[model samples]
Target chain A: MFPLSPILSPKGQGGGLRILTHVLALSPLAVLAWDFARGDLGANPIREVQFRTGKYTLVLLVLTLSCTPLSMLPGLKWVARFRRSLGLYAFAYAGLHFLNFIGLDYGFNLRLLREDIFEKRYAFVGLAAFLSLLPLAVTSGSGWARRLGKKREQLHRLIYLAAILTIVHFAWQDKAKTVEPLVYGGVVAGLLLVRVVGWVRRAARGTGSQTSSKEP
Target chain B: MDKIRSSEITPEHIYLGRRQFLVGAGALTASLVFLGGCRRLSELAPTPEADFCGSATAGATSDELGDPLSACDAATHYNNFYEFSLEKDDVAELARGFKTSPWTVQVGGLVNKPKTFDVDDLRRNFPPEERVYRMRCVEAWSVVVPWLGFPLAKLLKEVEPTSKAKYVRFESLHDPKQMPGQKDRSFQWPYIEGLRLDEAMHDLTLLATGMYGKPMPPQNGAPIRLVVPWKYGFKNIKSIVKIDLVEEMPTSLWTAFAPQEYGFYANVNPDVSHPRWSQSSERRLGERARRETIPFNGYAEKVARLYEGMDLRTSY
Candidate 1:
């Protein structure tokens, strides 16, 4: 049982929800900026920023994935409409996380960055995840999706791979405290399982109907 | 990596009292704002002499090193005392009210003169001396701390290790009730660490009692801890209660947990990378730029000779 608030309803004002989404998405960045200015980012500010941005990126991606499952409920198809915006926000945070690593931490030191990419498992997987999100973000517009047709769906399915890589990146980066990353991995696995189960049920039903028609 | 902030000393007890008062009032939200303001204000305010140790000498050795000492707030609050908590930032809060008094360190095993000295007696006898050193964490972060203590060599000499002793094993106090982190069975309790007898006798290896010219905070290994400047931070075991001079190499908590990742000799070597991450460079506390990690953490001239002819790559 879920709350039937206006935001969850099909008849809700799209403009209000869009504004709420943007405000919610931008608030973390604003808080980080404020903390940076006030010198409240603790001992290692660059690290604090990297951790926050990376965490939010995974969180937003999880929310974006959940939209598909939520939309299957009666009168909750409106949730699907927010998927693009949520996904783009996740992509934006991922970009910030990458920038923090390169610009702030590395000071655009190309050699060091290159070495990390090659030598470190976490760095390689993180870069791969971000690269996978890049194409999805670029072609997120409705125009490109329409032009590409079913191919667009196939391309966007890379989110699953991106999600898995992102979790691995996070889990590996932590020296200790595995629980937080493990929780994220579990959620992603559960969301993907829902989609797989739904697809399997539909395929079974379709085959059953085809066999029945052939018999008639 | 050493710099003295003699003028910047803020006693831990006074600060803890202030924090407790704010918490008592249930003004945690207001306290956050207060702390933010105090960060700027504390710098301008001159602090009084610490009451912990009378005639506590200032940092003469570290003043010439030139590397700015990390903020006392950061050095104390950000700790890897897994006995308290796994989270570095959370250790301070979690270790509050941890009893460090009435502490006795048992020095025995292969020592000719096995002795169990009360911590206070040891402190008084050795006298707190300031030795600021660069502490490089295995996680690739570092801090320069003005630790107040005498060398481990002095203590070991007093006990007089026998010819049979090859390695020195150190153990921390293990009370699961006081240290809630010990309740988690995933981690080994009563944190254990070891050093080769020679390494333990190195002049830089300190039996630290305090830092920033005050008594050590409970979070930062109150009463006493180890400070091995050349080795990674984990090797510098905290809140130590037992020191046994043994023949065999002791299995340290980290080494036992992941032997491949954390080797017995966790010396700071730029060439030797951790299994998961590079140790080539490290981010110093409060600085954005990364500094190249040198062999033996820049104490190579003094310590490189200790590891002569040994292949660092394989050993690491």
Candidate 2:
């Protein structure tokens, strides 16, 4: 008889692995917090901290979304378990990035802040990206998931739109089309294409199932 | 699962993790130490006094006066864009090799006396005076600079401009071997600048030989440069070699490159906007926020009289 065991059973083999994964995922956040506390954020610390946090947030968000495709592989069941924590970390960084911009860049000047958001195209894109991420971040925890019910999946799908806006925010700010933004855009385009293919297959299956049931 | 547990608990794994942590912490510590050192280094570079180079005597005051803080700050910070090793700070280093004593100013065109005046002779002929004025750049930045030199009008008096001389064209030193910018054909060099007869004679306009109570740093247009307040920074040409009284307007470096962007007059005006950015606001050196730029950079009281009954919009 084969050993009758769940691959990721919480009580057995996966418990230590789960703790290690959490530590690895949370380390960046801890380092960033330490950096802020020490005031070792580099010259022009406000800009430096905001840029780094925003960049890392986007990377983590992309990585969280990538878990779904990775988990589809036979040997990669553990990848799905890390997605929730990765997403929470992304939200944490994004919030910090937004707060830094408001406090440092605007100095809480409401009138100037409003003007910047409305008058400047780059600011508008950034604001849009922030707004898109807000709902997703709010709905990330299990409590919110339970309350959202059917709407939970819809809210999470907004991450795709947020990711696109993030890319635009970066690209538009760059006067020259340098390699950094281009690489981000390429990765995002590839990820979006994977979703598109999945959606098409699902739609095709639905149509085929309907025809077979009618014939039977 | 058993194999994975052994791998996780291995001595190599623990050692590697500890080593990585130490390295990361060490790198962070080193950077912090370096930054602290930099702050100390910056402090060591002597701070300028509030009234640096200002007149010490209460009674003796020059007509050309400016805010002293702005003047000293500008004298140090803002500089001519000499892209070569003779950059603003390093000019003293590179300039020691060059011979500035044998320099000559070629006076030709509509001047009655079309002759080469040795720099020493010119210096002796016109006694140098000190003038402090606000210098504003087209890039929407400004500084108050105290210039030590004589008026161009005084120099013009000696040359004796002919009746045909309507415009005064000034050219900068042109040696590709010396000035690397001269090698580029994109800009016509020796950099030429022109001023109308009345404008050149204006009391505010000075041919500066030195700044900050010392001989002009080689980077700050050593020997001589034109200082025209109420005009954009570029109008103040550097390291002049020739002064020609001409009939037509001489081609200016900035204006020639982009006529729409830079006009012949190049007078500082808040109304005239640069294509890329607004000219209405300017970042005064050491100021927190940008301030509204004034017409003729606040020299309208003196310079506006010269442009009486003339359209500034056309000239600008």
Scored by lDDT, the top model is 1
Q: What CAPRI grade goes to candidate 1?
A: incorrect
Q: Runs in model 2 with CA error above 4 Å?
A: A1-216, B1-66, B71-74, B83-99, B180-190, B275-278, B309-314
Mind giving the per-residue lDDT tens digits that candidate 1 earns over B208-282? 998877888888898899999988999999899999999999999998888878888899988876756558888
Residue-level lDDT of model 1, residues A1-216, one tens digit each, is 113335555564454445556767777777778778977676788988888889878888887888787677665666677789889999999999999999999888888788888788899999999999999999999899789876887788899899999999998888774697899899999999988887777667777565322100
Every model's DockQ: 0.20, 0.07
The i-RMS of candidate 2 is 8.9
Write model 2 residue lDDT over A145-172, tens digit each, in one string.
7898757876777888888888888776
Q: What is the C-alpha local distance difference test score of each model? A: 0.81, 0.68
